[model samples]
Structures are given as C-alpha cells and as structure tokens.
Target: MTAPDLTRRLVAELVGTALLVTVVVGSGIAAQRLSPDDVGLQLLQNSTATVLGLTVLILLFGPVSGAHFNPVVSAADWLLGRRTRSGLSGAEVASYAAAQLVGGVLGAVLANVMFEVEVTRLATTERTGLPLWLGEVVATAGLVALIFALARTGRGALAAPAVGAYIGAAYWFTSSTSFANPAVTVGRVFSDSFAGIAPGSVAGFVLAQVVGGLVGVALVRYLHPEVGEAAGDVVVPHPETRSPS
Candidate 1:
C-alpha cells in the first residue's frame, strides 16, 4: 500500500459523513417536530440510533476505504500506522479532508431541507462552550485510543461493532458527549434540526477535535511505544480485515 488510492477514501469520507450527519440531524428534526418537550429523550434516542448506524456503516464500508469519515481519524490512523495501506500519501489525506468538508456542508444543507429549516441553526439551540471544547479534546482522544487498541484485535469484522459500542459508552463518560469529528460537527450545523450547533462556533469545535486527534496519536506512542513503529503503516487487505489497519 504505497498511497491508498486516496480518491476512494475521500469518496468514502464524503458519503459516510453525509450519511452520519443526515441521520443524526434528521432524527433530531423528527424529535422536535414530534415532541418539543421531550427534547432530551429524543436526543438520546437519536444519539443511540446514530451509534448503531455508524457501527453498521463502518462494518459495511470500512474496507472499500479506511472509513475515515473524519480527518481526525485519518491523522490518528497515520500516527497509529493504519489509516491506509500504501495509498495514504499526502495527496490522499488532503483530498479526503477536502471531500469530508464538502460532504459535511452538503449533508447539512440536505438536513435543512428535510427539516424545512434555513441556515441550519435553530437559534434556540446552543452548544456547550469552552469547557465542552476541552471536553471534545478529551473525548476524541479517548475514542482514537480505543480505536487503536481494538484495531489490533486482528478482527476487522468486529471493528465497526466495537467502535459503535465505544461511542455509545462515550456518550455517558464525557462532558460534551463526543462530537469527535469536525466533518460531522460541521454537517450538523446545517440542520438546526436535532443536534445542530451554531455555524459560528464550528471553527473552535474543529480546533478542539484537531487537538484531540494529535493527542490521541501521541498518547498511543507514549502508552504503547513498542508498536509505535507500526503507526500508520499500510497493509494488504483480507476479508478478515476491516481496513488493512
């Protein structure tokens, strides 16, 4: 795996991010429309649904590409020696990031349509700020670290379910409830539907995710120095492999 045929991975990110956000926001919209007072239950229900959807999606498509729906995951995979096989060259990363960004925006727009909202933010909706920002950093770091540990399980088929479970659990452990990916976060902005956040705050949220991603890689190195050399190294795929880890 020299460069990973990044276009494929980018397309994966695009489609995956689109689906992730659409479901999340779309559910939120449904909850609001159906029961405004039950916002909390609706969010929890939607969050749970998204986790299952993500798990299934990862299991299904993680192989066609790395399933790196987020740049953070890509960066962490590079650091962990797993994002791509050989095609993970610089071009791959950049293209994937671009596609994710575009996908995110497009997903947001689509959510707006389904929810019959314009510009995404409901105004009544507010994001948890600075403290939550730091929380994002911590939350995403834990997620990447968990990814690394499970990735080494040598069971690609289990990766998606494992990742999904981690996310579901993470919702309870962390303060911000783990937005984790800039791409997903940005897409949510267009909905103002269920889990929508203010577009104005997207920059800070992205910054936090970036920071968390790096921290996760660094933590992996610090905690498991023996495997550090393998970080981001590509491998040939097998039916057994989720994404060539």
Candidate 2:
C-alpha cells in the first residue's frame, strides 16, 4: 500500500464506475428496444439488470477500491474517517472523484458504440421538478446512510447485495428513478435513452444528491455515533494505508 497501490485503487474506481455505467446505459437501451411500447416493462428490465450488475461489480471490485463508484460515497467515506487513521486524504478523495467522472463518461461511450448509437449525444429526457428533486434527496440520503450504517455495524460483508437491492428498489420508489450517483448522472447525459437525464436536469439532481449526502452524514452521526471495530474499513483497502499523503 504505497503510491503505486493508490494508483491501482484509483484505477479500480475508474474501471468499476465505467462498468457500472455500461450496465446502466446498455440495459436501458436494450429495454427501450425490447419494450418499445411498455414503459413499465422497460423500467423493470433496466432495474433488474442494474441490480444484478451492481451487485457483481461491488463484489468484484470492493476489495480493490472499496467499490465506491459514486462521488458522494467517496466523500462520505473520507468524512467518516477524518478522525481515524484509516480516513482518506483530501488528495485521494479528489483522485477518486476524478477517476469516477472520467470512467462514467467512458462507460457511456462504450455502451453507445456497442449499441450502434451516436457516441456523444446529449440526453433530452427532461426530469425537472420539485417532486423529483425531493425523490433524489431521499434516495441519495438513504443510500449514504445505509452504506455507512452497514460499515458502522461491522456488516461490510453485506454491502454488495444490500446496496444493490436498495438501488433496485429505489428505482421504483423514487420519482426520478434514483439517479443517485453523480458520476452516473454525468455519464447518463451522454446517452439519449431510457436511463438518460437531460443536461438541464443534471445540476438539480446533483445538488439534491449533495444535499442528501450531507443529510445522510448527519443521519449516520446520529444513528451510529461510535464506529465499531470495523468502523474505518471500506469496501477496498483502507485509503490511509494506500494513499501517499
């Protein structure tokens, strides 16, 4: 766990985010083609694929990058670890966010190429509204709180399936279909498909998600004040051990 190891961790984050976006965008495109007239069926198919794909990705990459494909998740991890020896440095957090953003965009591009679609088109699916924003806050808050809660309770092992299942359920329960990850949100902007979000809507969703992330952190503070024996552990190797800073 040194500078070279940090690079590997960042690569894992990048690759994991990229693969996740591929699953999301690819499945959405497939759902659109398979159920042209059935919106509900399209959603069903998309959500199912995302759930299974996400679970596998987390299990596959968690040990490498903590499987934090989401920017908010990385921030949360850093914040939670600030007082501990395992916390991520500011530089590492920045690296993770950058890698995830780049990865997400690449994933969208790969998905588009595989599906024979325009490679860099912007999404036009308008998802603007207070209700949807509220849904985003709720979805994101629940996600952040759930992840930290699990770690706080020494249940990191349950993260793969639990996190995946929560996202699949949130897709149905939330108005905006739970575009909870900022990197994922940015990635979806590159595709005009069932899972895509218009550029105009991205800011609002990102803002709501940020607010939700803050709320989630507060929730974790109140709900699990003391970090368990495994409190500082992440899905991947602890950042303090790998980061050069």
Candidate 3:
C-alpha cells in the first residue's frame, strides 16, 4: 500500500485533533447544561461522550494519519522508533505536533461557539497543584505505555477502543481528570467552560505530560525491549508509518 503524503497525514492529524476536542468541550458544555447542579453526573456524561467520540475518530482517521491527535503520542513514537528507523522522522513529528495543536485550538473555539459561549475568552478555571500534576504524569504514562504496548504486541487493531476505554476510566481515577495531552490542554485554554483549563495552568500540565511521556517511553523500553521493532504501528498502523510490503 502506498503511504500517505506528508500533507494528507497532517490534515488528518489536524482534523482528528479538532474533532476530538470538539467532542470533549462540546460534551462538557452539554453535560453542564443538562446536569447543572450535579458535578458527578456532568463528568460522567462528558466522559462517556468523549470515550465514544474518540473511538470513532480513531477508527475514522487511523488509516490516513494514525489518529494520534496528541503531541505526546507523536513524540513517543519518534523516540521509540529512532533506533530502528521504523517511526516518524523528526520533521514529521514536528509537523504532526503543529497540526494537532492548531486543530486543538480550533476545536475549542468551535465548541465554545456551538455552546453560545465566549470563544476568545481564556479559561478561568484554575487546575494547578501537586496532585493534579501527579495525576497528569500517571495518566500520560499509562496512556503512552498502553499505546506502544498494543503496537508492540500486534494488537494495534484494538487501539481505538482500548485507548478510548483507558481515557474514560482515567477520567474517574485521576485527580486531574486526566488532561494528558499537551495539545488538548492548550486548546482548552480557549474556553471558560466546564472542560476548560486556565492559561496559567497550561505550562504546568504540559510539563507534566512531557515528563510522563518520557517515563512511558522508559517503561516500554524496560518491558518490551524490542518494541522498536513495531514502533511504526503505535496508536495504529496508518499510511505514514505502515511498513512497506
């Protein structure tokens, strides 16, 4: 099969990230409106929507771009595949990250507009602190580990549902509500809704995610020393990284 060109892959990343954020922020808004007084119920509703939406998005875009939609995942892919030359090049990783970031911001704006909220307003919800940062580390570590593990184990076909399920569960288990993606964290800064995180908190969350990504990479190396052999399949076997037949 022919690999997708860089432009097409980038577009897929952009569109996929945008839609993921839309589902996240849009559902949060809807959940707030539907269950105004019950924070627990609102979170449940939001998480459910996000899980289903994310799974669908991955299935939809995985063929074209691997449906990473997260900078951490892309970076991890590059790092793991560096020695084997099976993963993305550094330039491709950069492009993917950039596209995901732009898409994330656009998705947040779209969500705010749909919910009739202020689109340009920075989030006022403060989500900083030691516990939240720790939660982010744990959440991101587990996410990266799971993704690469599946790829290495020849279970890439299950990534969509597996990733979606892990994230949905992380929402309940993690203290920080698992804002594990840097791109999404930045995107959420554009809204003041229930899902938004204040701009002030973005740096801390991003740093934690990066640290978590490193930890995840370390774990995959320790547990699956040969993971590099399947690095091209991380998240899913998209055209960009699919092995040439």
Candidate 2 per-residue C-alpha lDDT over 1-245 given as tens digits, one digit per residue, 9 for 90 to 100: 43237789889899999999999999999999999999999999999999999999998988777888999988887787766635566688899999999999999999999998898688899989999999999999999898888888878789999999999999999998998999999999999888889999999999999999989988987888864233346653343443324
Candidate 3 per-residue lDDT over residues 1-245, each given as its tens digit: 77888899999999999999999999999999999999999999999999999999999999888889999999999999888888888899999999999999999999998989997689899999999999999999999999999999999999999999999999999999998999999999998999999988999999999999999999988999999878888688765463333
Q: Write the per-residue lDDT of candidate 1 for residues 1-245, one digit (tens) a residue.
A: 24335566567678877877777677777777777898667867777877888887776557666576777876665555543342344555677778877887787677777767876344335676788899889978877776665555444456677678877776667677778888888777666556777767778888998998888777766776544333332121222222454
Q: What is the C-alpha RMSD of each candidate to the true structure, in Å?
A: 4.1, 2.1, 1.6
Better of 1 and 2 by lDDT: 2
Question: Highest lDDT among the candidates is held by which one?
Answer: 3
For all predicted structures, in order, the TM-scores are: 0.83, 0.94, 0.97
Error of 3 at 24 (Å): 0.5
Clashes of each: 18, 1, 0
Alpha carbon deviation, residue 79, candidate 1 (Å) = 2.9
Candidate 2 lDDT (Cα, 0 to 1): 0.86
lDDT score of residue 84 within candidate 3: 84
Residue 31 lDDT in model 2?
98
lDDT scores for all predictions?
Answer: 0.68, 0.86, 0.93
